[model samples]
Target chain A: MESLYLAWRYLVYHRFKTLLLVLSLTLLFFVPVGLRVLVQQTALELQRRAATTPLLVGAKGSSLDLVLSGLYFEGTRPEPLKGAEIERVQDSGLALAIPLHLGFEAQHHPIVGSTVEYLDFRALEIEVGRRFVFLGECVLGAAAAKELGLAPGSTLVSSPQNLFDLAGVYPLEMQVVGVLAPKGTPDDRAIFVDLKTAWVIEGLGHGHQDLSKDDAAAGVLKRKGSQITANASVREFQRITDENRDSFHFHGDRSAFPVTAILALPHDAKSKALLMGRFQSKDETSQIVVPSKILDQLMGTVFTVQDYIVAAVVLVGLSTLATAFLVFLLSWRLRRGEIETMVRIGASKGRIRALLLWELAFVLSLSVLLAAVLLLLTASQGGALLRHLLLT
Target chain B: MIRIQDLSYRYPEGGFRLLLPELDVARGEAVALIGPSGSGKTTLLRLISGILLPEAGRIHVGDQDVSSLSESERRAFRVAGIGLVFQEFELVEYLSILDNVLLPFRLHGRLRLRDADRERAAGTLQDLSLGDKMDRRPAHLSQGERQRVAIARALVTEAPLILADEPTGNLDPQTKGQVVELLRTKAGEAGATLLMVTHDHALLDLFGRVLEFGEEEGATTLVDREGAQ
Candidate 1:
């Protein structure tokens, strides 16, 4: 205890030196600890999301790309399989096969065109208003709503994939009819739209101006609105409403329409194996990918990198310890006269050495405390940022 | 009691050597050692206090042969037996004067300080007219005040032997007399033998016995210690 008291007095007397030592030591430890936490936290988060996604079947070009596009709705656009593929998967007596059509964005958030059943599949709940009921209506994820500041009755415009393709699909202004609860997943950054509305956005289904009443002489035409003025030049209805609900139609074979991928969950292990066998092919038309297995391979790479980081941190820690020891030795050497005085005053050399150790222990404890605080701050907020940039 | 027989000590580098044939001081005696600088007056005091061992002979303070003990054992013996005052007034600069006085009591197990120790330390400082400066550190004290603090620390332990080496070296004449008087009074009260080395012959009348060391010519060394070369 007397050793401790002397140590305390010395540290308090040389406060600036103590602070400098603590700060340097803390810098030496915080970075590695923070990176380690980020790696573990991200891995656990990614694995949890993969478990929720049972299996994803898409074009066989790249399984990684297919999984990224299908699960996150953000990646290279995969070759679209015919809609009948989803019907065949459903007919196989397997589990449900949910279709996804994602090739557009709104206010920089992915606009996912999927069925209402997808919501029930992901166990989502509406926090405000109801889901889409009309052709061009949409629902908002929690983050998307918070970012765009849109509630139930706001309107937003969908952006196309290729701006230079003038003859391709144009922008569609859809009504935000609902908002989802915050789920801390990639779904929280998407705009949910009906698959048919996605087809409408693709220019496969649309409502054009009627030219049945060719009144070239009168220079006017009667429309859904009670009154009609000039400037009735033919154009598309950007929004779908009950007044013109019947005017929308698709052109050709609906069964052969394109969808990006299909997310299927089998009922049992036997059924899942059967579905895998059905999609197995050496040819590169399409393939089945179990996201849980694929993510194991993905995280394997992450673990290798984590191992290297851990090794480098170990080396840095060793050198830092050496530096700290050298500093301690120099300080002790400077106090040789003081130590001699202490010995002359009946203080044993062992006792004085113990006092020095106490001083070092106090400094190290403080550095660990500082590192813990930094790790906690990063752990609390890293998930949101990672999901936004990588998952979403 | 202090006893020295056929004692001889020399530096490893072939420098000045000290050879004391025989000396003895009875308990509770007040003796003064007067000599020019480097005549081995302070060296003899250190050998008697178990601080430096002789190469040839033994020094016995009380019943223990200080030269025969290991370095650590000698330290414990010295802390229990002797109180020391020095020229530079070696008070720990960071500690308050009161804490410096109580330091010896806290450094070892047998001399562990308590409330009674605090009261005694306070009483010693009060006797030196330094009770009000107890909370002031050594840096804030004057030279005379710092010397008084050193004396208070020495006397607070009530050890059997007190050794002072040029304790008045940095003080004015008046302050020097006051410091010497305080040391004499405290050592007499504690019934401890007092040994002091000083150059001032005017204060010789204050001691019961006075001993002057031999001249510098009789002390031989391979190197001229006084020369710059």
Candidate 2:
């Protein structure tokens, strides 16, 4: 006890040196452990989400980008598939195709356009109010709701695709009908709207005042045999409401409307193989991909990278340990007089050694404890950190 | 009290050897040993304190055969029975004056540090006129004060034998005289045998007996100064 007390006093007297040593050792211990934990967590998270989402169908481009955009709502937007692809997959009786339109954003959160079944398929539960049942109505993810400070009955305006494009789609003020419970997934950060509302935001559909109305008479350019052409002065609705919703219309063929991807949920193994086989043809314009397979490959690469990182960290740790050992050796040399004083005062060899060992033990124990605390904090916050890394 | 018979010690590197046929100091005697440099005065103090063992001798301090004791036993005995003071005042700089004084009790497990030990340490510092500086480290003290702290450490153990090797070597003239006087007075009051080695001849009168080491036929010889007071 006395030796320990003396050791403690010595360390306290030289607190700055002791603290530097402790910090070095802490980083040495924490880096490798914390990195492994985060990598494992990221791997598990990617695999779990991808496993739950069985298959993805998108334009015949990068399968990785399609999976990233469809599952995580991140990465470069894949070339969009036609709306008719959903019906084509459904008619084959091989899978249920869920359309996704993901090019729009409101308040920096992605606007995910899908059918109401997307929520049920992903097992999302509404925490406030009801799901969107009409065009221009949106349901907020928990994080999106908290970030945008919009609850049920609040309105959110979509961001314009290009602020400089004068003839581009105007911003749409969509009504917030509900907020979903947090799932610690990409869904928690997305704003969900019906597919028609997304098409309206894309400027493919719109609501406008009747050209025959007397109020709009001045905005009309010409009329001939009940075919009227209106000039740009005609008022177009920026928001869809009960009173003006009937005025909204799409001018193109509905089947050809754009969808970024389709989540294909097959009936069973045979259906999954058949659907994948259908898209295997060289001339097929759309490609079907198994999400888990792509993610597994990605994780394999991540694991290899993690191995290199751990190796580098271990090398650095070795250097730090060597430096610390040198510092301790120099410190002992400096303290030779003090040790001699103890010896001449009848301090036994064992007691002298115990004093030195106790000092080292205290430093090592503090470093271990600090590293453990950091690792636990990383474990608890790993999901949010992975999301930030993946999305950003 | 100390007794040495047929004592012989030689450095292993082979340049110096000490040979003493016989020596004795009665209990409670204050003896000043004066010698030239490398005359084995400090070496003799180390031998008496069990810090060094003679190659051929029987050394007795009080009733214990110090030279015959094992290394660990000698350590325990030294901490309990011998108090040592040095020229450099070799106090642990990191420890406060009071902790320095209590170092012997803290160093050896044989001596259990009790509240009484703390009070004795505090009282020793008070007797040295360092009561208010008990919490001050050695670096914050002057040369004289540091030497006094070393003396307080030596006295705090209440050892029957106090061996000081040039305890006032670093002090100014007046401080050196005062330090020697204080050490003699403290040793007298505690009834301890004081064997102090010093180069200062002026302080010789402070001791009850004085022994001078001189070369005789290439061996060291101790001559008594006027037999005794």
Candidate 3:
């Protein structure tokens, strides 16, 4: 009890120095802790995404680019995989392939063009309206819908690639056929579409002709009653119909359009190994990367920086601890004459030592508690920002 | 009872020495050590209280050889049996008068401070005429009041031995008479052995015995004299 009183007296007597010590300890405890929390949660999110899908086959190019562009929603526009690659994987009979065509944008959001199978495997739920069934239809994720105020039947014009896109080469008005439920992942920020619609938006396919250009040229329009061959070959599928060919944006065959990446489930690790071995680049222009390995390597570098920060925090924390000890030591010395008086008044040496130690322990315990509170606040703040960054 | 046999001590730096061939203090006997300055009176008082150990001989307090005990054992013995009053009052400046008085109990972890203990502390304060100043810090007390607080602390412990080093040196003659009378009455009531060091010869009449010291070339010599009273 005497020691406790001494501790309280010391703290109250040196209030300013105690405050400074708490501040230094708070910084020492929270800075690196926050950084570690951010990095660890970010890596966990990336790892979770990576774990859901077994294989990613795209263009036989940089798998890191494919993972970044396809899975992480980062990186520049990737070189699209050919539709023939899908057929090749299907013919291999060792995997279920989901084609992803990404390159077009709608109001600054990337339009992810894939098949219905992709939606099923990704477990996306339609929150409003029906799924896309036509050429000009798109489905918006929750974040995209909320940000753009887009709902069912809302029409959205695609933003062009360049910031100043006066020429408007990629300007296609798409109707919002559905809005997706919130999925706390990168899916929340994307727009989904059918492969055919994606191909049409990329200027690869077209619907039936609405009119004849000959009659339009003669200033006589014909609609509803159009005469055309119903069994036209795939080669005749152009982005513009006969009547609107003059307004066609791009010239390409329907089957030969570009896609960003293809997500493939190779059934097992053996197949994954086989698939990866099949796609190994003999040339420097193409390479296959395991997403996990690449991520681990990236995180290794990130963790190194984090280690340095943690080390610095630990060193500073130790110094602050020393400061606290030094304060107690100085106070002990300052009160020596007083202690001697106490001894003269029948105080034992053991009691004096006990009082000193009790005071030190009391200060240390309070500072530790304060440090813990600060750490919790810092962790939660940093966690929220990271969650927003990764999910939305 | 306190007995000294051939006690001798050198300064910590070995530049000077105080030597006592023999001395005896009886129970209920308040003796004053009268001397000129630098006569080793304070050193002799410290030796009796176990604050300083004698280098060459024995100090027996109630048949216990204090100078032969280890430091820890000596500290325990001192806290339980001896009380000391300083000339400067040596109170903890940050502590209140009550706290200063009760410090011996606090340090011994015997801080029951129950109704009886508080009553005893209050009684000690009342004896010194310091009942109204219990809550005041030592720094706020006057020279005379601070001296009374120191004496109250020594009495509060109720030890068998009380050693005073120039307790009246900082007080005026009126306060000095009040303090000296308080000490004689309290120590006598407790049956404690009282030894005091002082430069004023007039204060020796209150004690039964007086010892005088002289500084020789290299040693302090002690002589005993019965007080005229």
Highest lDDT model number: 2
- lDDT (0 to 1) per candidate: 0.83, 0.91, 0.75
lDDT of 1 by residue, A274-361 (tens): 9999887676477888887777787798779878988898788778878888888998898787677777878887789888998898
* Pairs with backbone N, CA or C atoms under 3 Å apart (clashes), candidate 2: none
| Rank by lDDT (best first) | 2, 1, 3
Once fitted onto the true fold, the runs of candidate 1 whose alpha carbons sit more than 4 angstroms away are: A15-41, A57-66, A69-95, A99-116, A124-262, A266-288, A364-392, B1-6, B12-15, B21-32, B55-73, B91-98, B119-149, B168-193, B199-210, B215-229
Total backbone collisions, model 1: 0
- Ranking according to TM-score, highest score first: 2, 1, 3
Query: DockQ: which candidate is best?
Result: 2
Candidate 1 collision pairs = none
Question: Higher-DockQ candidate among 1 and 2?
Answer: 2
Best by TM-score: 2
Any runs in candidate 3 off by more than 4 Å, and if so which? A1-45, A56-262, A266-289, A306-392, B1-34, B55-73, B88-99, B109-115, B118-149, B167-212, B216-229
Error of 2 at A205 (Å): 3.5
Q: Write the per-residue lDDT of candidate 2 for residues A1-392, one digit (tens) a residue.
A: 99998898888888899999999999999999898998899788878999999889999999888988999998889999999999999898999988999988998899999999899999999999999999999999999999989899999999998899998889999999999999988899899999999999999999999898899998899999799999989999999999999999999899999999999999999999999999999999999999999888888987899899999999999999999999998999999998998998999989999999888998999999999999999898875686567645
Distance from true location, Cα of A357 in model 3, Å: 4.2
**Taking chain A of candidate 1, what TM-score results?**
0.80
Per-residue lDDT for B66-117 in model 1, tens only? 9999988888887888999989888887678998898787676568888988
Give DockQ per model, in order: 0.44, 0.76, 0.34
